[model samples]
Target: MLGAKRETVSRIISQFKKAGIIVHENGNLVVLKMDDLKEKAQ
Candidate 1:
């Protein structure tokens, strides 16, 4: 597991969700579409 702060991880997950980059399911973070996420990153 990543040794990041809970608040930091929560913020990151929220941001990613809002950006359509990821989804939360069953207490897990899933990458919805890697290609789209990668495109947005660049």
Candidate 2:
């Protein structure tokens, strides 16, 4: 568990979606740009 609130997680996921870093398909999350995602994580 990341220990983050659900709202916090949801917001971050929404940001990622907006940035085209990830997507939700068939109830699964797919990473579109691993390098970009890693950069964002930093």
Candidate 3:
């Protein structure tokens, strides 16, 4: 997705999880801090 390699995407997601930005449950990714992440994205 977004032209990123599979492993690279996985690592980024892992960082998000560790940073309290997201959580994985029941195979779903839940964003814990959308505004924070959104601002970071920009």
Candidate 4:
């Protein structure tokens, strides 16, 4: 649990998915672009 509201988490996940930085596959989250993800973290 991220400790945030479910809606907030879902929104962020959607953003990441749209950005092609992550994906939801078979009920699991997969990071498609690790470098991009790290960049976003900064």
Candidate 5:
């Protein structure tokens, strides 16, 4: 895991959402796809 705080995780999730890497639904976070994130991270 990332070993981040709740707020930190929330913030990062929000950023990822903005970048279309993941999505929040029904109070849960789901990774829509990892390709974009992986590609951009490299």
Candidate 6:
């Protein structure tokens, strides 16, 4: 969605996953911790 390269997107997703914000389940992407994501963004 960010129009980033496939590798770049993967790297970002990996970071978010490591941060305990997003998850992969049943072949879908789930946001489990929005507050932490927001805190990191800020």
lDDT of each: 0.57, 0.58, 0.59, 0.58, 0.56, 0.57
Cα RMSD for candidates in order: 7.2, 5.9, 5.5, 6.3, 6.2, 6.3
lDDT of 5: 0.56
lDDT of 3 at 31: 35
Ten contiguous residues minimizing lDDT sum, candidate 6: 26-35
lDDT string for model 1 (1-42, tens) is: 235466765687688788976755623434334334446766
Q: For model 6, how does the per-residue alpha-carbon lDDT over 1-42 read when each residue is reduced to its tens digit?
A: 434466765687788778877756612533334335545756
| Candidate 5 C-alpha lDDT tens digits along 1-42 | 334456765677778779977655623434434334445656
Q: What is the number of backbone collisions in each predicted candidate, taken in the order shown?
A: 0, 0, 0, 0, 0, 0
lDDT tens per residue, model 2, 1-42: 135566776687788788977757622543334435556776
Query: What TM-score fits each model?
Result: 0.47, 0.52, 0.52, 0.50, 0.46, 0.51
Model 6: residue 27 alpha-carbon error in angstroms:
4.5
lDDT of 4 by residue, 1-42 (tens): 324466766677788788977756623533334335556666
What's the residue-level lDDT of 36 in candidate 3?
Answer: 52
Instruction: Kindly list the per-residue Cα lDDT of model 3 for residues 1-42, writing each as its tens digit.
Output: 335466876687788789977767623533334335556666
Residue 40, candidate 6: how far off, in angstroms? 20
> Worst ten-residue run, lDDT, model 1?
26-35
Task: Give the per-residue Cα lDDT of candidate 1 at 24.
Answer: 58
